[model samples]
Target: MSTVGRPPGRGTDEPVGDLVSRASQQISALVREEMRLARAEMTQKGKRFGMGGGLFGGAGLIGFLAAQASAAAVIAALALLLPVWASALITAALLAAVAAAMAAAGRRQVAEAGTPAPQQAIDSVKADVTEIKEATHR
Candidate 1:
């Protein structure tokens, strides 16, 4: 019975040069496959980063709204005992603090990401180098 995946030549006793050339071809194929895997991995990482950041931003938005409402409620509660200006000032400060905190967290996360641009650029250069090597020797 013939094996479906094996080429007939794979079963042959071939010349050493033929084996070497075939090995080179296989190496090239392996590199191509590795490049593909890396691309896929980076894409998945980017997707996860986006999804996580989006979720975080969404939560932050909800929290911001809740914070503002709660601050207003606190101000109203305090208005009974405090001057109008003092109550408004305290609530405004609380809201500003919350906004600043969220902004800082977002900025830090964006900085940590530092963009996928560098990773993709490096992979492209590696692939180009591989191609050039094959071309030069041929």
Candidate 2:
């Protein structure tokens, strides 16, 4: 009942079309798994970045409080040499200038940090796509 040259797949067991369909399904599953892996990797990096930023913010807050206390001490010392109001105003002005400079520097640094997308994952996915396209073309 089997053909002379062509395999019995067309008549028995799984046909060639079914095998092709299965291969496609497996490829799709592989792609989904790769996506999941990429997502997990990105999430891990995001968490680490968030934690670092939070720690920096907390340290900055503590430093600000310390600086305020130090400014008060400096003003009190200066008051012994000049009128209290003049000493306080001078201290306040100096502190304000320093704070402004620091704020500008911080802003510039943050702007330079740029976006936090998963670039490696994106590149890998792009390579995979290119490979798939080449294979399909062949």
Clashes of each: 0, 0
Q: Which residue window of length 10 is worst by lDDT in model 2?
A: 6-15
Residues 1-138, model 1: lDDT tens digits = 565787765755568898899999999999999999999999999999999999999999999999778878889887988987799898888779988999999999999998768898899999999999999999
Top-TM-score candidate index: 2
TM-score of candidate 1 versus the correct structure, residues matched by position: 0.52
Q: How much is 106 displaced in model 1, in angstroms?
A: 17
* lDDT measured at residue 66 in model 1 versus the true structure, 0 to 100: 95
Q: What is the C-alpha lDDT of each candidate?
A: 0.90, 0.92
Off by over 4 Å in 2: 1-14, 96-138
Q: Which stretches of candidate 1 lie over 4 Å from their true place?
A: 1-13, 90-138
Candidate 2 collision pairs: none
